[model samples]
Target: MSRFAGRFSGRRAVITGGASGLGKAVAARMVAEGGQVVLWDLDQALLDKAVEEVGALRGVALDVSDPVQVAAAAATAQAALGGVDILVASAGITGATVPVTEFPLDNWKRVIDINLNGVFYCCRELAPLMLAGGYGRIVNVASVAGKEGNPNASAYSASKAGVIGFTKSLGKELAGTGVMVNALTPAAFETPIFLQMPQSQIDYMKSKIPMGRFGQVEENAAMICFMASEECSFTTAATFDTSGGRTTF
Candidate 1:
């Protein structure tokens, strides 16, 4: 048997931003471990492709920032998969890199809406389902920027920091219950999202990491899988750093 045998068999997982990057990686791993996954993302074509590639999976088009859509999506997923056993709130965006003074309020709000409010929406909608089931695992995708603010990415940094705080608070609220909530603070990873960033901004991020390289999606996915499993029973309301030594703290 695999070392992770029975880790997630018969479990149902819902991953936001599951069409690509770290979210997709986690979904693939969960299914490999015998779990069913419901992937929600804004990109319908990509989501459909992911669903086709990963057996025992379903895909839904969703904008995480939209409460109405998220609620509807959650209801559909719960109906199809028999409720969520794990939730990975990974939908986010790295907003434009501009000095705080130059950053447009609209851009900042957009970033916060998707990264911070999006997480809240998912948790708010899904937590009740998990609570009813009497078991759940929640892993919110945060960033090293959340812990240590980056120079040119104020909105992204602040939003992710909010995610960390929110996860901690929720974890505490669910204490003594079977549900567990946690956040992962990852350093730069070679994901498609990086392509959206300017090369100079990317270089600045790379220079800060002591590892001299970007993190792998597989590594982040592995960490997430562990956090979502029954094996992660003890830890909750905590931050797990996968920063490749970028964060000495």
Candidate 2:
């Protein structure tokens, strides 16, 4: 993984939810490319360890759903990195799994707050940094559920759908600003995040994938890195698919 093609050399990146799973994988890759990275996650202990593990410049304990935390972290990043060239809004969670009518209101709000609003807050606070530099790449991690709603996961589905829409609007807003915004709609990947789901739900999602299995974290990191790289030039506000044919739209 340390081949170092220098694809992200001298780049500074902040990846929310960089403690583990897909986010963690991306952080490792970016660092291997000679980029400076800061891992942002809600758990202090996890963040501390991930920064060391991924060789990231540092780790910031951030709850992106909290605008104050986001703003403070944005300032921290601005001061530390001086200028950020990449942002991967990958922090999120899977709330309780249940029928919409049976869904807990508290659970719904929590999911939306973290999955949808968190992405918005990070972009809101950090996009200005990118705009100021006149060069940036943002890859918002969404899900195939956003495109094809998953029953019993209403909040998760709706929140991710919001991410896709947000990415589109922001992409266009920064069209000529040298900052590109895009999103990924990926199929279920077998990560610790997947362990949060019920066995039945996991099985259901895997069945939908034409590949007849869940995706790997490395498979996801590959797409995410491409989206975060300078090579992503010419594409903005678009939804890239990694759903193994479960979604082609």
Candidate 3:
């Protein structure tokens, strides 16, 4: 699939968290398919390395949770890239694993700020660019945990749940505006985000997947590409599952 060409030819994309993990995988796929991608992440060094690795991919150090930063980045990105046609809201973090009753307030807020709020900030700022362009594709990377809440992962679960809701609402609002908004709910994939979780928690998550293993980054990226492509017409305010048989709906 990496050898395939021009799936996203002549398109421009803004991908949050594209420095690594699932986000990087998607960026690679898009660029390989002939799309121009501008990646936004918090780590400048990693973003630089990723851009070099992906070849022709642009990098920006952005904190998506900040609306001011998001707006500024959007303006700069639009100016440089001409305009954004697709947005992959993949920047997120999984806070510490703990029971809701024991969850620290700060951790909960942090998770929400990044995972849920970040998605909102990106869409709120960038969707207008797409809307004005008269075309757009938004694929918000949510989680299966949002559907079937993971025990002891209250903050992560809640943030993702909020994303699902936000995607639906936003999708509807943009239904007739030549833009489609959707969410991808993937079950535990072997991404760097795993480093933030306990091994015990990881094992428990694996146990819930009928596939009996973590998902592959490529698999999720494939779905995202389809969702971000013109072939994804007529699907908005919907949740596409990439959960390895964990979610049939």
Candidate 4:
């Protein structure tokens, strides 16, 4: 289904984490549907590569956790694209795995800052623009861990849980407005993020999934594009799970 087939022909989008993984997949899909895209990420090399792959799209090196940097990036994106019709906040990190009692404070904070706070920073700066325009869509990438905490991943779970709450609250606040806010709770996806974790941890995660396999970046991207499209008019403040039945509730 081409939900955004011709819908984004003249529209513009801002995608964080667009350098790779799920973000890159979503940005590619958006561009395929004829939208002008601005990709934001912290890795300059990856961003350069993504720009090359996604021809005609702009790329910016942005640290989402830094409010000043996020704000500046948003401004630059708006200036370049004229204005953002869709904002996909996909920049995130998988924190080190360990029991809560043993979890390092620095690691916890880093995870929270990147996964949750970064999303907030983007929203805080971009929401107003959408509200003013009286039309916008925000799709934040969350995780199934947010709904059901993983055994040895307190920081990642908590941060993603925060994303759920944040999305819900913001969605309600903008219910009457034209802007729609939503989050995607995806299970383990075979992305570069997973490469950061140990093989044992990866194996454990895959075992827990009912599908007995990791999710694909394209699968997650499909859902994100739907939520970011104009057709997603009624669904907001909700978590759309793509967890391969890992989260049936």
What would the TM-scores of all predictions be? 0.98, 0.98, 0.98, 0.96
Model 2: per-residue lDDT, tens digit, 123-214?
99889889988899999999999999999999999999999999999999999999999998999998888778999999899889998988
Encode model 1's per-residue lDDT on 149-197: one tens digit a residue.
Answer: 9988999999999999999999999987899999999998899999779
TM-score of predicted model 4? 0.96
Candidate 2 matches the true fold with a TM-score of 0.98
Tens digits of per-residue lDDT, candidate 4, 29-134, equal: 8888888899999989899999889753789997899999998998998899888888999999888888888999999989999999999999999998888889
Clashing pairs in 4: none
Off by over 4 Å in 4: 1-4
Task: Output the lDDT of residue 165, model 4.
Answer: 97
The collision pairs in model 2 are none
Mark the regions of model 3 whose C-alpha exceeds 4 Å error after superposition. 1-4
Question: How many pairs collide in each candidate, listed in order?
Answer: 0, 0, 0, 0
Candidate 3 yields a Cα-based lDDT of: 0.93
